[model samples]
Target: MRLFLVLAFFGVLSLSAGVLMSGDDQDVDWLIAGGLFGVALAGEGARLWLRRGRAKSHESSGI
Candidate 1:
């Protein structure tokens, strides 16, 4: 979970940098940015899924 958060943070940073640098130049970094953003999304989704699973398990266990 922490690892996913870190990866997502880096992905967001890279995406921001790419967007900032691409000032109408059709830069290739845009692709990198998109990919990073996708990773970020995936990481966040996975994190949420894991958290939800944990919560359900805890509920079932009466913890």
Candidate 2:
């Protein structure tokens, strides 16, 4: 699950960067890049929050 999340985050970053740096300033490209960025951020944030929650629970349970 962690590997999957990391891959997804990197995939979004790559796609966004590719589209934005393709020398095309079209509106659609911008929209796509923005969407990718948003998705990447959300994925990363969720992974971080979940990890933190799991660690806290583990500590509380003396794991």
Candidate 3:
């Protein structure tokens, strides 16, 4: 879970950098790739979070 969150954080940083890039360093393909990578990492992080929540709930309910 913590690992996933850390990956998501790095992904977000990459995406932000891609979007905010300017001058001669900007590339549309790189921007799109970064955005996709960020989304994927964030989705995985969210899945981990939801799975953790469901596990806790089930344990509490004696399921």
Best prediction by lDDT:
1
Q: Write the per-residue lDDT of candidate 3 for residues 1-63, one digit (tens) a residue.
A: 777677767777776666666447665347665776767777777988999998988775556
TM-score winner: 1
Question: Could you give candidate 1's per-residue lDDT for residues 1-63 as a string of tens digits?
Answer: 786678768877977878777888756477768777777778777988999998988775556
* TM-score of each prediction: 0.56, 0.54, 0.49
lDDT of 2 at 25: 57
Clashing pairs in 2: none
Candidate models: Cα lDDT each = 0.77, 0.71, 0.71
lDDT tens digits, residue span 1-63, model 2: 976777677777767676766665543355556666667778788988999999988775556
Q: Please give the ranking of all candidate structures by TM-score, highest first, separated by commas.
A: 1, 2, 3
Full-model lDDT, candidate 1? 0.77
Q: Which wins on TM-score, candidate 1 or candidate 2? A: 1
lDDT of 2 at 14: 62
